[model samples]
Target chain A: MKAVGFKKHLMLEEEESLFNFEQAIPEATGHDLLIKIEAIAVNPIDVSVRLNGTETYETPKVLGWDACGIVVAAGSEVSLFEEDDLVFYAGAFDRPGSNAEYQLVDERLVGHAPHGIDIAEIAAMPLTSLTAWESLFEKMRLELEEPSLNQDKTILIINGAGGVGSIATQLAHLAGLHVIATASRPETIAWTKGHGADQTINHRRSMPKQLHELGYENVDYILGLNDIDGHWKEIAEMIKPNGRIVSITRNEQPLDLGLLKSKSAEFMWEWMYTKSYYQLPEMITQHEILEKIAALLEQGRIKSTANQIIDGINAETLKAAHALIETNSSIGKIVLCK
Target chain B: MKAVGFKKHLMLEEEESLFNFEQAIPEATGHDLLIKIEAIAVNPIDVSVRLNGTETYETPKVLGWDACGIVVAAGSEVSLFEEDDLVFYAGAFDRPGSNAEYQLVDERLVGHAPHGIDIAEIAAMPLTSLTAWESLFEKMRLELEEPSLNQDKTILIINGAGGVGSIATQLAHLAGLHVIATASRPETIAWTKGHGADQTINHRRSMPKQLHELGYENVDYILGLNDIDGHWKEIAEMIKPNGRIVSITRNEQPLDLGLLKSKSAEFMWEWMYTKSYYQLPEMITQHEILEKIAALLEQGRIKSTANQIIDGINAETLKAAHALIETNSSIGKIVLCK
Candidate 1:
């Protein structure tokens, strides 16, 4: 099987940063689906993993999380998927990823691809959609089934034009929350508003002041998608009493949790890979969330967040995607397809 | 009106630490109830407030929270209670406290006192009960209405013989959860078992090892009532994936929140005064919770946690109660009554 991987951590400009390699296709075991990769998306995690490690790998580390693929074979214990099924998934972190011709993924993490979406669009939806869905419904404990109860509630999404933020804005809106999203650039602001943000604030400025200017004293919830340490104080100031905040970014410095004592606020971290890494009992909920997202996509209720697509799934294309993400100005997802 | 108060923060042995004083009885305003005090309880917060501040008031500041009293008058906007109603309440933090002949409290924060309980028993309840209730059902997000669903769930309560812990152990047991409480001394262990702990462990030792020895690797919920900084590592290690933890104690040092990142667990602060301090829209829920608590008390579903009572509502009695709390070995609660 052909794969794009690296033996050592290096800058994107280096010749060996990401290189083509060959390996034997792994056989499916219990609950595993052998996937033939069709399309893949690059996220910030990929860049972080690529550049932050120093140890050279014994084998080239294949790195990609989001993928649209066709199942070539299914393990004996697999019940959710079969051969020839078109699926999408954010593969596990500890295993070989989807930047390959052939990969094995747990059936519980795989979802049926939406019928009307292109492969690139399907690839973009899996990782971000699952993150958005779980952050809102599970971590924040929103009642998606009771939109009426959520009608008066509000949510602030920091970095509204980013991959997960774009989907989160849509899901929060669909759940009947008044959405306030933060975006600095004019184009990004417009993009966020188009995707279901009722109002947009500039993250480059004081978010609390921006929210106050928009006539909101505080919000019922906040979904933080970028720069957690930078926006944490504003988030603390802008959350209502007893409000909940969920963040995807890891903080480099220690957070002053004492600031939230009087408000009795809840803080949760949503790492999309947590379930698969811990082998949690509810790992199958990812498949359920993605199925709902796929249905929503087919129904035209939510659009794909794929903003850019490259021609081929190879070392050069992946390197280009990584560079674009490193610039920190990409509005949405960037996908690579074969 | 006769009251016990302090002009400055001082050690308990000081003559001026708590002294008898005279003041004009305050009149009730909007939503306020002027109550004639019957009994009051001393909690850790009282000691915290007394010893942590340097400001000396021109007029001595009264300090007490949990009380069972008679409504001498009601404000014009108050609808929940009228004059002559017997009530139990944990008064607002910013208001003049219950260490007086007369005090004014918002009706929403007061509950109808249980008919079958003594004044000292009812006084011991309000503050600790409210804290325990909010920490479990609200902050931990437990489904208290569906006891059967919670049968398989387990909750670990640290420092289980203290004021809030005693009540929390009972509430968690009543919710059908398997309760594991920590207590070092023989009397405290017996007290916790009598209060509804299914099992007891010694918090004086490594809690994770104790829990593993008791045939448990992780818990579904954790209510932290003691030193959070000391127990944080054990809490992080002993919480199940996606579990919830609520704590009342503020951490003296910054916590390494990254420890729970892979488990995707939740951490929340449960300050009993938060709703009233912030004047949240859901402040009326306190009234509702206490009303239910009153009914439960009448039905004998849960018993009052009052362990000792001192006769007379005066400076010397309050000083004795405060001294008992400062010892940090007192089980349940200490109350003073006229």
Candidate 2:
């Protein structure tokens, strides 16, 4: 099988940063499914994993998360999938990724792809949608209802034009929350607004003041997609008593949790790989969430967040996608198709 | 009305630490209920309010949270109670406390006292029980069912012989979780066992090793009554992936929240006063919880955790109770009764 991989962390401009290589197609066993990769999406995580490390690997590391594929074979223990079934998934962190012709994945983490969606669009929906869905519904425990209790409650999405934030804003709106999303640029601001943000605040300015001007003294929830340390003070100040905060961002410094103590707020981290990494009993929840996402997409309740598409699944195209994501200015997801 | 209060932050041994002062009785208004206090419980917060301050106040600040009393008057909007109702409550943090002969509290934060329990026992329950109940049921969001899905789950209660822990261990036990409680002293260890702790680990020791010795590597839930800053690293290390941690203890230092990212764990602060303090729409939940607590007490499903009692609700008695709490050596709760 042909795969896109890197033996060392290097600048994207370097020809060796990502290269085409031949690897054996792994066998499916113990609930694993052999998937033929059709389309893949590039996220900031792929860029960070590629560039943030300094040491060279003993073997090439294939780095991709979101993939739209078809199951070519299934393990004896796999009950959920079989040959020729279309699937989409954000694969596990410890395994060889889907930036390849074929990959092996746990059937429990794979979901049937939404019918009638383009390959690039279907590929873009898995990773970010899983993250946003789990963060809002599972981790933050937002209750969905006909007349949701979240109608009066507000949610502040930092960096609302980012991949997860784009989907989060839409899902939060569907959940009946008043959404205030942060976007510093004109195009991004308009993009977030289009994604169901009731209002937009600039992350470059004081979020609390912007929220105050928007008439919310404090938000009932905060979903941080950018830097958590940078926005820690603002999040603390803007969270209501007993509010929930879930972040996918990394904090370089220690967080002053005392800021949320008086309000008795909760803080949760949403790493999409946790269930897969831990082999948790709820790993199949990913399958459930993705199935729901597929329904939402097919029903037009949510549209694919794929903003840019590049041809081919080889090294050169992946390098270009990584370069775009590295800029951190991309409005939505970047998809690469074979 | 005579109140036991202090104008300055002083050691409990000081004569002026808790002095008798005369003040005009406050009238009930809005949702307020004027109650004649018959019993008061000394919690860690009372000691905190007395000792952790800088400048003296213009007037003495009364510091007591839990109380059992008779309602002498009700505000026009107070529909929950009327004159002559026997109630128990942990009043708001921003208002005058229960150390006075007459105190005003919101009717929503008060519960009808258990019919047959003594005032001292009832007073010892409200604050600690509320903290425990909220942390377990609300913060950790544990489902209530016997032989629950929690049967295979484990919980670690740090400082498991204190007021909240004594009740929390019993509650967690009743919820069908395997309880690993921390206690340093022999008496506390015995007390924790008596309260339904399945296993006891010393928080002063390497908690992870102790857990490993007991055939467990990580816990499914953790309830921290000890210092959060002190046990943070241990708690983070021993918490299973996607676990929940709820703490009633305040961390005086900044916390490294990044530790829980990979595991995607949850951290929540449990301040019993948050609902009433914010006048949140869910403030009535406290009244509902207390009513349940009273029923649980009546059914013998839970027991009062009052460990020591002072003879009178006066300055000297309050000073003794405060002194015991300040030492941090007291077991269970200390109450001062008329």
Candidate 3:
């Protein structure tokens, strides 16, 4: 099988940062499904892992998470899908990635791909959608089926132009919340509003003042997508009494939790890889969430978030996609197809 | 009205720390109830306000919260209680406290007192029980009525012999979780066991090792009652993946939230006065919770946690009760009666 990989972590401009290589196809065992990769997505996590590693791997480390593929074979213990079924997933952190011709994944983390969508669209939906869904429905405890009950609630999504924010804004709106998302640039603000944001604020400006201008004293929930270090103070100030906040961003310094003490608010972290990395009992919920995402796509309630699609899934194309993701201002997902 | 209050912050042994003073009685208005105090419970908050303040008040500042009393009057907007009804409550932080001969409190924060319990016991329950119930059922999202469904879960209560821990352990036990409470002294351990702890660990020791020796790697939930800065690292390490931790203790330093990131855990602050202080819409829930607490007392499902009772509500008795509460290891609530 042909794979795109790196032996040592390096910048994308380096000659050996990523290379084409040959590796033997892994066997499917113990609920694993062997899938032939058709399309893959480049995320900020892909860029992070490629540049952050300190040790050289004995074998090349393939780095990709979001992919749309077809099941070529299944382990004896597999029960979810049969061979030839198309699937989409954000694979586990510890295993081999999907930037290859074929990959083996746990059936519990895979979902049947939604039809009537392009390969790039399907590939872009899994990772970000899973993260957005889990952060809102699971961590923040939003009522998915009871959207009517959420009519009076408000959610503020920071960095509304990012991958997770794109989906989160849509899902929060679908849950009947009044969505308030933040974006600095005009294009990004328009992009966020197109997704589902009822109102948009600029991250570069005074968010609290802008929020007051929009007639909200405080929000019931906040979903932080990036720059938690910079936005945390505003988040604390904007949350209502007994409100909840969920963040996927890393903080450079310690957060002062005292600001929320008098409000009796809640804080939660949402790491999409936690369930699969720890093999938690609720890991199967990933499959369930992805299935729901597919249904939403099929119903046309949410459109795919893929904005830039590149041809081919080689070292060259992945490096290009990585460069785009590193720019930090990409409006939507960047997908790579084989 | 006669009140035991302090004009300046001072040590408990100081003559001016708590003194008998006279002030005009406050009239009830807008959902307020004027109650004549019968008994009051001395909590650490009373000690805190007495010693932690820097500025002197024109009039002495009263520093009491928990009380069992008879309503002497009601405001036009009051709907929950009638005159002459015996009620128990932890009044708002910004109002005149229950240390006075007569105090005004919001009708929403007051609960109909339960019979069959002594005045001292009833006075000791309102503040601590409200903190415990809000932390467990509301913040942690535990199933309150579905006890059988919670049988498989486990909770750890730090400082199990303290006011909140004593009631939290009992409530968690009644909710059907296996309760592991922490108490260092032999007497406190015995008291905790009697309260509802299935097992006890010493918070002063290596808690993770003790928990492991008790045949558990981690707990599903943790309620922090005191010394959060000292117990934070252990609390983070001993919490299970996707767990919830609630604390009433103030942290002197910032907490390392990164420790719970990969595990996707939740942290919540449980300030019992938040709703009333903020005049939140859910303030009425306190009345409902107290009514339920009264029923539980009537049904003999939970017991009052008063450990010591002192005679009289004068400055001398209040000073003595405050001295006991200032001790680092008071086992249960201490009440002062008139």
Candidate 4:
């Protein structure tokens, strides 16, 4: 199968950074499902894993997490998916990712793709949806099924225009929380508000003052989507006593947790890769969440966040997508389709 | 009413460290409950409030939390208790404490005292019981009533022979988790095991190595009762993926939260005073918890953690008790009674 990857981590500008190659199609065994890639999505994790490496790979490492594909074969233990079943998934962190034509993904991680949406749109939803779902419901323990119970609750999504933030703002709003999301630019602010943010604050400005002007002393929960270390103090200040704070952003600096001690606050990290990286039993929940997200999309309760869909799944197309991601101003998801 | 307090924070040996003074008894209003002289329990917080200060108090600051006494009066808003009701409570942090002949506490923070327990025994329970309960069930989100569901879980309680630890060990045991508590001394080890610790590990040594030898890779939950800064690395290493860690022990230095990032772990602060300190509506949950604790005591499902009962709730007795706390070797709780 033809794939795009690199033998060594390098900058996108380099000649050997990402190049097309051919490899034998891997077999489906145990819980694995051999998938023929249909469309792929770009996320910050893809950029991080591509650049933040020192070791050289014996074989080129195919790098892509979010994808919607058709299963070509199923393993002996595969029960969730079958041959020719259209599926969506955020592939495991350690595995050869979805950039390849024939990729092997565990059946537990695959979910039935929504037939109502295009392949690129279905590909865009999995990674961000799973992250947003787990951040609010699993890590923060919000009651998603009982939206009425969350009527008085409030949540602040730190970066509301990004891939995960766009979805999180919508899900949190759907959960009946008074959503306060942050976006610096005019277009991004409108984008966040369109996605169900009740109020939008600028990440570049003083968020606490803006939050105060909106008549909330503190929010019941905080979902940190960008620059967690930079926003730590504000997050600590803006969280209500006994509030839960979940962050998917990686902190480059130290965070003072003592600020939350008197408030008895809860801090949870919702790394989407945790379940797959650890091979935890709850990995199957990703499939369940994707199924729910697909239903929500099909019902028109939520729309796909795929903003920029490029033609072709080749090395050149993925490189252009990665460059757009590097700009950090792109709203929602960027996907590549063939 | 006579109260033991100090105008300025000082060492225990100082003449002005603690002194007796008479003041007019306070009136019960709002949610206040006026409790007459009975018994007061000494905790580490008392020592902290007494010594960790620099400014001279206008009115000598009274310091005590746990108490069991007859409610001499009840406020207009008090529905949980009536006048002359015997109650146990851990009073709010900002209010005048229980180191007095009479103390006024919010009724929501007070619970009906168990008739089966001695006054000093009941006094020793409030602060410690509340801390342990909040740490285990509320902060850590452990299902206490449904113990069978927790059969596969394990908990590591750091400092298992101290006031809060003694109760926490029992509570975690009742919750059906395999309790591994830390105790270095032979007597402390025996005391921890007696309180239902399934295994005793030495905190002075490498906990993860010891844990490995005991047929466990990592604990599902960790209750950090002592030296959070000291055990932080090990706590980070020893917590299983998606584990919850609750700490009452304040970290003097900054703690790196990034260590738990890949595992997506949760860190919660279990400050028992948060609800009352913030005047949150859920302060009444403290009353409900204490009521449950009293029933547990009455049923012999749990026991009082009081180890020493000093006669007289006076300046001298409090000073002596505070001195014992400063030693950091005294196991269980120390109480003063009239």
Candidate 5:
């Protein structure tokens, strides 16, 4: 099988940073499904794994998480997927990822791909959709069934034009929460509002003032997609009493959780790959969430965050996608299709 | 009206640490009730307030929370209690405290005193009970009615013999959870066991090894009644994936919240005074919780945590109680009654 991977940490411009390699196609075992990769998306995790981790690797580490693919074979223990079934998943962190001709994913982490969407679009949905869905419904404890109760509540999404933030804004809006999303550029601000943000605040400016101008005294929830340490103080001040804050961004410095003590507020971290990496009991719920997200996308209730789609699933195309994501100014998602 | 208060921060032995003062007996206004204070409990918060904080107030600050008294009068807007009703409460932090001969408290923060408990015993309950109830039910999201579902779960209560921990262990036990409490001393261990801990581990020892030896690997919930910074690493290691941690103790330094990222765990602060201090919409819930707790005590389902009773609610007695709490070795609660 042909794969895009790296043996050492290097900049994306380096030819060896990501190169074509040949490896034997792995056979499915236990709950694993051998899937023929059709499309893959570029996320910050993919870049981080490729560049930031230990450089001493015995084998080239294939790094990609979001994928739309078809199962070519299934292990004896697999029950959710079968050969030829189309699927979408954010595969586990410890395993070989989806930047390959064939990848093995646990059936519990795979979801049926939306019937009508293109492979690239479906590929872009899984990682961010799972993150956005779980961050809102599970971590933030938002009740989608009771939109009326959420009508008075508001959520502020930092870096709202990004992959996870785009989906989070949509989900928060669908839950009937007033959405205040942070986007510095005009295009990004317009993009966030198009995806369901009721109001937009510039992350580069004073967010609290902008939120106040939009008539929200404080938000009931805050979903931080970028620069958690930078936005910590503002989030602490902008969260209502007993409010919730969930962040996907890593903080460079320690956070003063004491600031939230007076409000009796909660702080949670939403790592989408947590269940799969930890093999937690709730790993099967990822399959359920992805299926629901696929349904919503098919029904047009939610839109795919796939902003830039590059043709071909080769090392060259993967490197291009990675380079675009490295800029950090890319609005939504970058995808590479077969 | 006689009151014990301080205008300056000073040592307990200093004449001004807690001094005698006189003021008019405040009239009940709106939801307020004029209570003839019979007893008051000195909590760690009282000691912290006296010693910590940068500002010295122009007016003498009366520092007390837990109180047991008779309602001498009720405002026109008060409907929950009448004149002469025996009530117990942890009144609002922004108001004049219960360390006075007569005090005005919002009816919503007051509860009917248990029928069989002494004034000192009842006074010991309000603050700790509210903190425990909120930490377990509201913050940890434990369901009290559904014991069957709760039976499989376990909760680790840090500092199990403290005022809040003593009550929380019983509540968690009554909710059907296996309660693993942390007690450093033999007397505290016995006290926690008597309060309903299924097992006890010394917080000073390896809690993780102790839990594993007791046939458990991780806990589903952790109520941190003591130091968060000291036990953070162990707590992070012992919490099951997606577990909840609620802390009442304040951390002097920043916390490494990133440690819980891969597990997607939650951390919440359980400040019982948040509702009243913030004037949150859910302030009424505190009243409801106290009333229910009062009923539970009346039915003998739980008991007051009062460990030592001082002779009177005067400066000398309050100073003595404060000094005892400052040592950080008090078993349950310290009450100063008139």
Candidate 6:
């Protein structure tokens, strides 16, 4: 099987930063499904994993999470998927990722690809959609089914034009929340507003002041997608009493949790990989969430977030995607396809 | 009206620490209830307020939260109670407290006193019961009515024989959760067991090791009532993936919140005064909770946690109660009555 991988953590300009490699296709076992990769999406995590470490790997480390694929084989114990089924997933964190011709993924993490969608669209939906779905519905515990109850509630999404943010804005809007999203650039602000944000604020300025100008004293929830330490103070100040805040970013410094004591606010981390990493009993909920996302996509209720699609799934194409993500100005997502 | 108050923050032994003073009885206004005090309880907050500040008031500052009294008057906007109604409450933090012959409280923060219970019993309950109930059902979001769903879940309560802990243990048990409480002494252990702990661990030792020895690697919920900084690491290690933890104690040092990131665990602050302090719209829920608590007490589903009672509601009795609380070894609660 042909794969794109890197043996050393190096800058994108380096010749060996990412290169073509060959490996034997792994066999399906346990609840695994052998997926033949068709399309892949690149995220900020891929760029971080590529350039942030110093250790050289014994084997080239494949770095991709979101993929659209077709099952080639199923494990003996698998019941959810079988050979020739079309699927999409954000693969597990500890295992070999989807930047390869052949990969093995748990059946519980795989979802049926939405019918009639482009491969790049299907590829871009899994990782960000699952993250957005879980952060809004599960971690923040919002009532998606009771939109009437949620109509009066509000949510502030920090970094509204980013990959996960784009999808989260749509989901939060679909759930009937008054969505306030932060975007610094005019294009990004327009992009976010197009994707369901009812209002946009500039993250480069004081978010609390911006929110106040828009007439909200505090929001019912906040989904933090970037620069957690930098925006934490504003988030704490802008959350209503008994509000919830969920973040996917790691803080460089310890947070002053005492700021939230009087408000009795809640803090939660949404890794998205937590279930698979811990082998939690509810790991199959990933499949359920992706299925719902697929239905929404197929019905055209939520549009795809793939802003840029490259021509091929190879070292050069992946390197270009990573380079784009490192610039931190890309709207929505960038995908690489066969 | 005669009240127990202090002009300066002083040691309990000081003559001026808590002295008898005279003041005009306050009239009720807008949701306020003017209550004639009968019994009062002392907590660690009273001692901290007495000895941890340097500010002196022109008029003596009164500091008592837990009280059982008879309502002498009601404000124009008050709908919950009327004149001569027996009530119990943990008054708002910013208001003049219950250490007086007459005090004013918001009707939303007051509960109808349980029938047939001792005045001291009812006085010991309001502060600790409200804290315990809000921590479990509101902050941790545990379902109290669904015992069948909660029967298999487990909750670990640290410092289980303290005022809040004793009530939390009883509430968790009544909700059908398997309760694991921590106590350091034989008397405290016995008290916790009597209050409804299914098992007991020594918090003076390593809580994780004690839990492991008792055959639980993790708990579904944790209610931290003691030193959070000292017990944070253990609590992080002993919480199940996606579990919820609520804490009342303020951490002296910044916590490494990154520890719970991978498990997707939730951290909540449960200040019993949050509703009143923030004047949240849900403030009336305190009245609803206490009404339910009154019914539970009337039916003997849960017992009062008062362990020691003093004779009178004067300065000397309040000083004695404060001294006992400062010892930190007194089991359950201490109340003073006229």
Q: Can you write out model 2's per-residue Cα lDDT over A1-338, one digit (the tens) per residue? A: 99989988898988989999998999999999999999999999998888888888777999999999999999999998879999999989999999999999999899999999998899998889989999999988887544368888889999999999999999999889989999999999999999999999998899999888988899889999998999999999999999999999878999999888879999999999999999998999999999999999999999899999999999989988988888889998999999
lDDT of 3 at A245: 97
lDDT of 5 by residue, A222-291 (tens): 9999999988999999999999999998888999999999999999999988898889889999999989
- Give the Cα error of residue A37 in candidate 6, in Å: 0.7
For candidate 2, what is the TM-score?
0.98
lDDT at residue B80 of model 1 (Cα atoms):
97
Model 4 CAPRI quality: high
RMSD of 5: 1.2
> What's the chain B TM-score of candidate 5?
0.98
Q: Model 5 chain B: which ten-residue window has the lowest total lDDT?
A: B51-60
> TM-score of chain A for each candidate?
0.99, 0.98, 0.99, 0.98, 0.98, 0.99
In order of appearance, the predictions have TM-scores of 0.98, 0.98, 0.99, 0.99, 0.98, 0.98
Candidate 2 wrongly placed segments (more than 4 Å): A144-147, B145-147
DockQ comparison, 2 vs 6, better candidate? 2
Collision pairs in model 4: none
Q: In candidate 2, what are the lDDT values of residues B133-186, reduced to their tens digit?
A: 999999998865655678998999999999999999989998998999999899
Candidate 6 error regions (>4 Å): none
**Interface Cα RMSD in Å, per prediction:** 0.8, 0.6, 0.7, 0.5, 0.6, 0.6
- DockQ of each candidate, alpha-carbon based: 0.83, 0.90, 0.88, 0.93, 0.91, 0.88
For model 2 chain A, where is the 10-residue window of minimal lDDT?
A: A143-152
Question: What lDDT would candidate 1 get against the real structure?
Answer: 0.93
- Identify the leading candidate in terms of DockQ: 4
How high is the CA lDDT of each candidate model?
0.93, 0.91, 0.92, 0.92, 0.91, 0.92
Sequence-dependent TM-score of model 1: 0.98
Clashing pairs in 2: none
CAPRI verdict (incorrect, acceptable, medium, high) for model 3: high
Please, what are the lDDT tens digits per residue for candidate 4 over residues A160-272? 99999999988988888899999988899999999999988887888889988988889999999888999999999999999999999888888899999999999999899
Question: With candidate 5 superimposed using the best TM-score fit, by how many Å does residue A87's alpha carbon deviate from the native?
Answer: 1.0
